[model samples]
Target: MQPIALITSPFTDKFSIPRQPGLAPSVISTVSFVGDFDHTASIEGIQQYSHLWLIFEFNQHRSHQWRERVRPPRLGGNKQLGVFATRSPFRPNNLGMSVVKLVDVVVKPQIKLVVSGADLLDQTPIVDIKPYVPYVDAIPEASSAFAGDEPNQLEVCFSATAEAFIDELTSNAAKSEHYQNLRQVIIEVLRQDPRPAYHASKQPERHYVSQLYDLELNWYVTGQCLTITEIRQQKDF
Candidate 1:
């Protein structure tokens, strides 16, 4: 199927994205319609809904081979399960779905959607969009098996240098709202502890780097705390 839109998000890399949507609500994204689907009429009345279900493709792994059984990060990447039982990207269809909060629907100049709590990587292709019906979509008694509970959150802290650096970055005039919420966004993302599941036991003291927007995050986890060691702006090539 052809793509209906593409996502513009701060998560340039999959390494640090939250395992699930709404895990980092402060991170915003734009869903810009593309090709033949770039007409405002296609999404009339979409603004009435507070949330949407985005059907997207794992375009980054389009060329990769699919396996019948895969290891899930939630299982510490140790236990293997059938591919259909997990949400691993290495699937035969390479499709993914997420429920995102619809911040706004822009119809002028070009059709676009301002959404939040999206875990999609930058430029992920969207196949379809559907309004979220709370009555039917939410299952109060649903059982999620081993993934029933939310992951534990770590206490995210910033170094004095990291705080000052964030201040300097947001101090400039004409900055966008996303720029102003940089600190909180970083905190929300880090609190999820964006590390490989196995690393918690194997490489607890390792330093890690992740890309968010135009910035490079330098962080480390110790005990139940995660610290931002540095934040650097990536230079344009």
Candidate 2:
């Protein structure tokens, strides 16, 4: 299906993206509609809703091949489960659904949506948007099985370098609000620990460097504490 809009976020890459929505609540993103859908008529009543369901594409996955069985990171990435049983992206159809807080809906000039708690990668394509109906959507006795438990959160500490970089970023006149959320998002992201499930066993011997927006995050695991060793702006941009 053709995308009605494309979403933009600070998550420039998937390497450090949150596994699901609401995990990093401070991170905000926008959906700017295009083509025929970028009009007030298409979303006349959108602003009334407090939350929306987004049907989006996994545009960054290089392969569209289907995997009948998959290992889930939540299950330590060791046990194989049927593809249908998990939210594996390597499915027959690489479609994803997420519930995001409807921060605002702007209809004038061009259709745009402000949302929070989305797990989509930067520049993700959105096929559909629907208002969330709490009466039907929020079932009281839902059984999530393995996904019922909350993910473990580690202690995150910012070093002097990280603090300095974040302070400077928030002082930017044009992009202060966006970067202001970055610090909280970073803490939430790291608290949940961005390392792959397999990499957890090797954390003591390994170091990681990933990007969020134009900043490079240098971090390592020491005991139960995850330290931000350095934070630098990427020079490529």
How many residue pairs of model 2 clash at the backbone?
Answer: 0
Candidate 1 lDDT tens digits, 28-55 = 8999999889997899889899999999
Give lDDT per model, in order. 0.90, 0.86
Where in model 2 is the C-alpha error above 4 Å?
235-237
lDDT, residue 27, candidate 1? 85
**C-alpha RMSD of candidate 2:** 1.5
TM-scores for all candidates?
A: 0.97, 0.95
lDDT of 1 at 89: 92
